[model samples]
Target: MSLKVKFDELKTLAGTELGTSDWIAVDQDRINTFADATDDHQWIHVDVEKAKTGPFGGTIAHGYLTLALLIPLWTELLDVEGVTTKVNYGLNKVRFPAPVPAGSRIRVTGKLGDVEEVPGNGLQLTADLVIEIENGTKPACIAQPVFRFYA
Candidate 1:
């Protein structure tokens, strides 16, 4: 595990890799639960037998499901100290470059891109996060996630 640092220290890390998260498995159960919650029971995501004959050769997680994992992955990777509140501003850009098949392990590598000071002792951070799949040529997702933290 990496040591936690104060939010101010993050500013010095601009244009550098902040951290990488531990591997997280994208299993069938997780995919099914997401599909159930979102009412997106697409054959490519849920039906293993059908998906085997489909394009991906096996059941794949939904792109949104992979996107949602960024939150937890980011949390596991870093911590912001001395902040009264931290909120997800939104993504500047997001792309699902490749599908993550069931049982595949994935992790996030975050690079601190830009950090700007806002009014009221707040800071806006833009992180370029890449979700890398284990043993896979392509990443599961790539996104520029933004956050606003108030001290």
Candidate 2:
């Protein structure tokens, strides 16, 4: 469930865990679509038959595709209310620790790392986010995402 809080309540939750998001599948169709969108037609991500004999044993989701998922998954964990504008400021310390095989399920867990005041009556929030592959030994991705919320 998402942790809903007004803009002013943000700072108080620093160091708190927002929660884990519902698992979402990273199927071959989804991977193909992402590849098409990004014009990244690497064989490991698009050519399923060839990928079966490749390093990971099967087609795998692109690392950036998994990273892009943070947007929607984040909404499943946090809802900042009463903010006129919310921005995905940027990312920090991003790492793809493991591969996400196509047809696998993935979920995210996030912690509120910090909240700081910024210019223009806004708050800068940093979230330590981890994306885990179902039944996988290591996380698919780890990222520190920064968001800017304007009242």
Candidate 3:
């Protein structure tokens, strides 16, 4: 579903649970691509042979790779309507609480924590996002992502 809140109306959503996203897989290829792009080809992330004896028993996705996935993963959660522009402001807090193995699926649940007016005709929103990995006891990541919506 879509979020019907306008730029100014976002303030009304403070302290509310906004939306939850659909599950997205964290496959080996995607993990490898992230390792390649970031030049962080750690054996645990890229070398299956070496990772077999590693701590996780097999290759585990890089923490940052899972963090980066939040962008596309958020798309399944909700759509914004009636906003002229939306910009990622930054993150407040972020943590990788669990390892994400390749082939695992993940999803995000977002809560609207804060909303404020900016200098221009823009609204700033801070959302607490928790990304859960299927079958994992701990969430893959917990973060507070901020965004600005200009009308």
**Higher TM-score: candidate 2 or 3?**
2
Every model: Cα RMSD to truth: 1.3, 0.6, 1.4
Comparison by lDDT, 2 against 3, better one: 2
Question: How many collisions per candidate?
Answer: 0, 0, 0
Lowest summed-lDDT stretch of 10 residues in model 3?
A: 1-10
- Please identify model 1 stretches exceeding 4 Å from their true place: none
Q: Which portions of model 2 show Cα errors greater than 4 Å?
A: none
TM-score of predicted structure 2: 0.98
Error of 2 at 58 (Å): 0.5
Q: Please provide TM-scores, in order, for all candidate models, with all chains considered together.
A: 0.94, 0.98, 0.93
Task: Report the Cα lDDT for candidate 3.
Answer: 0.83
- CA error at residue 50 for candidate 1, angstroms: 1.0
Better structure of 1 and 3 per TM-score:
1
C-alpha lDDT score of every prediction, in listed order: 0.91, 0.96, 0.83
Q: Please give the distance, in angstroms, between residue 124's alpha carbon in candidate 3 and its true position after superposition.
A: 0.5
Ranking by TM-score: 2, 1, 3
